[model samples]
Target: MEAESREAGPSAALMSAIVTEHFVLQSAAGTTVSEALGRSSLYLSALSSSLIALGFASQTPGLLLPFAAAALPTVFVLGVFTMVRLVGTGVQNVLYLSSISRIRGYYRTLDPEAARYFARWGAGEGETDDALGSLAVQGGPMAGLFTAASMIAIINGVLAGVCLALLTYYVVTDHHLPAALAVGLFAAATSLTVFFRYQHRRYLKVQQ
Candidate 1:
């Protein structure tokens, strides 16, 4: 009996350690999500306030151009910062969840009978089994575009387009509205494409 206890002791201690690590990872994952939401909210709030101020500026003659020139660039930079941090937090959360899933797999190994109670970790190894994963698979490539980070990217892209349009109107195109519009649209589309590509590359790196 004493020999049996000694042999079991290491296994029990290992299991305990694994369980503790699982809990820590779960908490950390939650924190990453919270941080992502917080950062997004901050960016959106700033955007909203900037738009309101611009609206007021628009009502005043001569103030619109100067105010927009000052505000838009600042807002765009803030959006960039926010989007980067959000992506980081998002990736961090995924990694944490993956670790937790792996720990759950270990748990299943220890208690095969309890396997039925644990949720499937993913569609396959390395893939997350969460709602995001489901959306990505079912919704296809466009599904990846629906994330908070993407939303910010789109908004920032539009802001970039607007900035470029304004510059074209005031300087490049000599106030030619059509030319400005075309330039703006091009800028916005290019910015969005670049942002999406960057995000895809980051995720691919994470997967690797």
Candidate 2:
């Protein structure tokens, strides 16, 4: 039986089933990552807002600058976490897409009636402009904001700016301009660390 199977090879139905199963698994993995990302973002937003509100309401020294300064590292950590989750989700999506592309290739080998089932259902064969393909577009004025990575970066960049400003204010009020400058350096370090450690290898690596 093993020799006969080796000689005949697996049937198209069996291969398609295997590829479809992989696609489903990858899709589920991506969904789980997205859910985790959403939960993390929501919790961070709620906590940050609540802390700001509480700090403003209470009779605290430095006008909430101290609280904001303390929260800066926490925000950085959350941003790094979000970037990691985004990478995981993106990897899953790419794997799912690869599985679908393979399935399409298999379908193309079949009869026309069978091939029509998988024909260009948004995830086309050679087009590749589904989600991240907008990156290839030039001078669209808003093409850069198309991918999930860009959205994550923009949202976290805004949060980082807020945190950095608050930290600078805190340092300047309590210490001096020199101290504020040091805090700014620390903000740059934090962002660079997050980018290099979590995001660069996964998202920005060259495909050579």
Candidate 3:
């Protein structure tokens, strides 16, 4: 009974996110909102799974207590808040781009003073302007944000899959739960450290 109830946690979170996304998309305009909904739905699913896993893992006599207090809101806030920020940033960028007449014109060579201001030493704004300016002008930020959200979704799904595999091992060969914990922790660590940071870190590295 505890296991069965705990299993419902992720499912509830998933349904909540999907409904929320659907409503948000209905009111928002442009591709950013659509992309955001897509990304949110994916992240929500992953977090929901994690929520369910954690809840079930805690399978005490009263599983719903843990899920209500801990699991559901954690997944909801993490997924929704990030999506909201990304979408807001995307909309602001679109508005900024709309202000300028010629994106190409903005590429006018960066003055030495401006280079010092931006600390873009040896970096060419004539080329980078279009790319980076997209943060304020084009959909580049949205695209990049989507990529990050997608990577997170993939990471969670992979972790869940690893857990399933470990469970299979335990059932098939009677291995202890330690095997599952080790594999699950390894995947969690990699997901948190690698996939979460990969894009942002790589971007900074490239800039430097």
Candidate 4:
């Protein structure tokens, strides 16, 4: 009986560990979908601002296609993302609606045992560590997301480097080192400010 109980403890822990990972994956997938949507929003906004500035449209509302080529990529990305969001839509729709009714009924009938179950599993922090924490501590989708963010940062760094090279060329060819310095400084400041503002907003949203 003692040996059997000891083995049972680890088995139960392993099951709980699986459940924890599931929720983390759900949260990450939802977050990734949200980020993709944000990218499309940014692209659309830039397109709108540039087109309006260029006077691409008339006062009428019935003519706008060739004038919107810049937004085509944004539309494509949104279409692909919409299909991705359809993944598991059917099951979730039913489970969610059904769970609403059944869970309410079950909630009304809860006893001490149900209360304790809620205490252990309601907010999803279990006796063991979260799935995202354990698996992604070393590497996984969370790490992949961080890796993606890092890659974006690296790309921006490379672009800044190219800008610096251009500044060097301008300084050498035009012999206008002062003007070059001003442009370079302004470029760097603008890039840094934009990057930090984006990161700041993202961090604030995550914290909230």
Judged by lDDT, which candidate is best? 1
Order of models, best TM-score first:
1, 2, 3, 4
Candidate 3, poorest ten consecutive residues by summed lDDT: 101-110
Which prediction has the highest TM-score against the true structure? 1
What are the runs in model 1 whose C-alpha is more than 4 Å off?
A: 1-10, 127-143
Cα-based lDDT for every prediction: 0.79, 0.56, 0.48, 0.41
Give the runs in model 2 whose Cα sits over 4 Å from its true position.
1-16, 19-23, 26-33, 36-40, 47-51, 54-63, 120-145, 172-208
Give the per-residue lDDT digits (tens) of candidate 4, residues 1-208: 8799765544657546655655654565556546655654554465456447436554546333333333433433443343233322312322332233333334434454554443322222321212223223222223222433333333343335335544454435465666656665665556545544554444333222
- Runs of candidate 4 with Cα error greater than 4 angstroms are 1-147, 164-173
Span of 10 residues, lowest total lDDT, candidate 4: 120-129
lDDT of 3 at 72: 44
Better of 3 and 4 by lDDT: 3
Off-target runs (Cα >4 Å) in candidate 3 are 1-33, 42-130, 133-147, 154-158, 161-169, 172-175, 188-208
Backbone collision count in every prediction? 0, 0, 1, 0
Clashing pairs in 3: 97-137
Taking all chains together, each candidate's TM-score versus the true structure is 0.87, 0.60, 0.35, 0.31
**Per-residue alpha-carbon lDDT of candidate 3 for residues 26-130, written as tens digits (9 for 90 to 100):** 344345556666776666686778767766766676554444445544554565456445535444433433333122232222243443333321123433344
